[model samples]
Target: MPARKIKLSTSSKVFYVICYTVVALMAIICLIPFILLISGSFTSEQFIRFHGYSLLPGEFSTEAYKIIFKTPQRIIRAYGVSIMITVIGTFLGLLLTSMTAYVISRKDFKYRNWFSFFFYFTTLFNGGMVSTYIFYIQYLNLKDSYLALILPMMFNVFYLLIMRTFVSSIPHALIEAAKIDGAGEWRIFFTIILPLLKSGLATIGLFLALGYWNDWYNAMLYLNTETKYPLQYMLYAIQQQTQALASIASQAGIQVQNLPSSSLKLAMAVVATGPIVIVYPFVQKYFVAGITIGSVKG
Candidate 1:
C-alpha cells in the first residue's frame, strides 16, 4: 500500500512562509554586525577614519593585523596561556560539577536539600567585590597565579543546577540495577552516569570554556606580570597602550600617524574570538540536546 501524503492547507502554507521569512530576517539582522566587524578589521585605518565602517571593505589592508602580530612571541605566549587555562578549567569544572550534581540528585543522599539550599543561597547573595578580592588575594594568596583565572569560574551554581536536573532525570531503577550487579558508586558513575551525561557535560563545558577563554577581569586584578597575561588581556593591554599613545601625542601637539586605533579594535576582536567560534560548531548538537533535555522536569 502506498503511504498517504499530507498536504498543507492554504492558511498553513501562508503561516509556514511567514515563519520562514521572519526567521530569515532575524538571522540576517544578527549576522550583519559580524559582517561589519570582519570588514572593518580588514579596512585601512585612514579609510575607516574618513568613511566610517561599511558592509564590505572599501579599502582592504592587513595593517591592523600586522601591527598586532608584530611581536609574534608575545601573541603566541598569550594564546598558549589562554588555551592552557581553558582546557584545565573546563575539565576540572565539568568533573566537579557532574560529581556534585550526581551526589545531590541521588534520592538516598541525606541532607541533599540542605546542601542544595546552601548552594542556592550563595547565588542570591555574595560577599561583594571588596571582600571577594580580599579573600582571593589576602587569604588564598592567588595573586599573580594562573589559578586566579581557573578557580573563580570553576563552579557556577547555575551550571550545577542544570547538571543536577539532568542527573535527576535518570531512572532510579537503573542505578539500583547497577548496584545489584555489584557496581559501586564510583564504578556506576564512571561506566553508566558519565556516558549518559554527555550532552549535559558538553553544554556546561562550553559555558565554562567560554568563561575562562574570555576572562580578563581576574587577570587585571590578580595578575601583575605581563608574562602571565591571557589572550584577551593581552589584546586589552594593546588597546589601552594605543589609546594612551594617541592621548599623549595629542597633548604634545603632534598627530600620531598610522596608529590603526579603530581598525585595531576590530582586529583584536577577530583574533580573540576566532578560535572559540571554530570550536562551537563541533559541540553545537550536544549543547542543544543538553539544554532541551535539561529544561524538561519530570
Candidate 2:
C-alpha cells in the first residue's frame, strides 16, 4: 500500500505562518532603502533639504537626473570601462581557475597533491598590500594601466579551492573508463569531465563578474588618469568634488560649473546600481541552483 501523507498540526501551521510573516517583514526591511533611494533620486534638493528623504516624498523633481544627464560623455565612458573589465575578467578568471583546479583534482596523478599544495600555499601567505603595490606599481610598472585592475585578482585562492573540490567530487570511475578507451588526459577532461562542472562555473563566474563591477579600490590606487577611471571611481570623484576637492579648486581660482550635487549623487548611484539589479534576477536562478549543487558531493 502507498504511504499516507502526514498533515500539519494546528501548532505547526501557526509556526509556518509566523515564519512566512517574519521573512516577508525582513524582505520589506531590505527593500525599503532601495525604494527610498529611488524616491530621493527623483526629488529636488530644495525638497530634500526642507523635508529630508522619506518613504514617500512630499514633492518630486528630476533635478538629480538633469545634473547626471548633463555629463553624458563621462558617464558613458565610465560604463564602458566597467563593462570591459567585468566581461573580460569573468571569462579569463573562470577559465584559468577551472584549468588549475582540473590539474590538481586527479587522484592517481603523481603530482596532484603537490600541485594542490602549491595553490593552497598562496592562501596561507601573500605579499603584504604595500609590497604588492610596490611590485605592481614600481617594479612591474602597471600603475594607471587597465592591467592594474585585472591582473592583481585574476586567480583567487578561495575560488581555486572551491573549483578543485567540485572537480574532485566528479566520479573517478569516469576518468578510468575514459582512459581504458584510449583517451588522453586532455580528451578525458574536455570530453568526459568539464561538462559536469557547469554549476561551479556559473557560481564562480557570477562572483567574479560582481567583483569586477563593484570594485573601486583598484581604480582608486592605480588609476589616477581620468580617462581610464571606472564607473565607481568616476562617481566617486563627482561625489567628492562637492566638498573637499571643490574647496581646493576654488582656492586655486578654478571656476567650476556646479550642478545640483545632492541630486546628482542619487542619479549616479542609480546608474551604477541599475545594471546589476537587472542582471540579478536572470542570474539568480543559476546562482541558487549552482551554489546548492556545487556545495554537495556528486
Candidate 3:
C-alpha cells in the first residue's frame, strides 16, 4: 500500500517560515563582519577616518597590502615557518595521540585505566605558565628553536580522550580476527585500526594544524631570530610597530607615508586567516562525522 502524504497546518507552516527567516538572518549577520574586513582592507585611511568603514571600500587602495609585501622575503619566510611548523606538528601529534589512544582503547590492556587517568589528569590541572616556560627554556633548552613550538602542542589530552572513545566503539572481533591471522599489534593497528579511525584523525589533524598556524605566543617567548618568527608573530610585531608609529605621528602632527595602519591590520588579519579558512571546507565532512561519532559512548 502507498502511504498518504500529510500536509502541514497553517500554524505549522507559519512557524517553519519564521524559523527559516530567522536562520537566514543569522547567517547574514555572521557573514557581515568578514565582508567588511575584506572590503576595509582595500580602503584608504583618509576615507576610513572621514566616512568610517563600509561594505564597499570607501576609496579603493592597495596600500595596506603593499606595506605587508614591501619586504617580500620576510613575508615569504614567515609563511614558510608557519607551514613547516603546522605540518610537522600535525603529523607528530596525530601519530603519537592515535598510538596512545589505541593502547588505552584495548580491553585486555591491563593498565589501560591507570594510563588513561594519568593522561586525563593533566587536562584537569597543569603546572602554571611560568613553570612551563621555565622548564622549556631552562631545562629543555628549547629557546630560539622550532622544537619549542612543535613539542608543547604535539599531544593534547582532550584529543587523546576523543580518539580513545572513538576507538573503543570499534568491534573487538576485528582485533581478535587479526590476532587469529597471526597479525601483531603494530601490524593490526596500521593495517586495520588506523583505516577505521579516518574521521577522528582528520578532526584531530585539523585542530592540530589550526593550533600551530595560530600560535604566536611560543614564538614570541622562545624565538630570538627574525628568520625563525612564524607568520602570526611576525604579523603581530608588525601591527604593534604600526600602532607605535601611528601614536608618534598623531602626537607630532606629522603624516606618515603609506602607513595605512588600520587597513593594514585588517589586511594582515585576512592574510593570517585565509589559509586555515580554506582548510575547513576540505575537512568539514570528516569533522562532522567525528563529532557525530564522539557524541555518544559505546
By lDDT, who's the top model here? Answer: 1
TM-score of 1: 0.83
TM-score per candidate, in order?
0.83, 0.83, 0.85
Q: Any runs in candidate 2 off by more than 4 Å, and if so which? A: 1-18, 177-184, 243-258, 289-298
Residue 159 of model 2 has an lDDT of 77
Q: Could you give candidate 1's per-residue lDDT for residues 105-142 as a string of tens digits?
A: 99899988898889889978999999999999999999
Better-scoring candidate (TM-score), 2 or 3? 3
Better of 1 and 3 by lDDT: 1
Query: Which window of ten consecutive residues has the lowest lDDT sum in model 3?
Result: 244-253
Q: Each candidate: what lDDT?
A: 0.86, 0.79, 0.84
Best by TM-score: 3
Model 3, 6-69: lDDT tens digits are: 7778887888899999999999999899999999999998899888889999799997777666
Give the Cα-based TM-score of candidate 2 against the true structure. Answer: 0.83
**Where is model 1 poorest over a 10-residue stretch in terms of lDDT?**
244-253
Choose 1 or 3, whichever is better by TM-score: 3
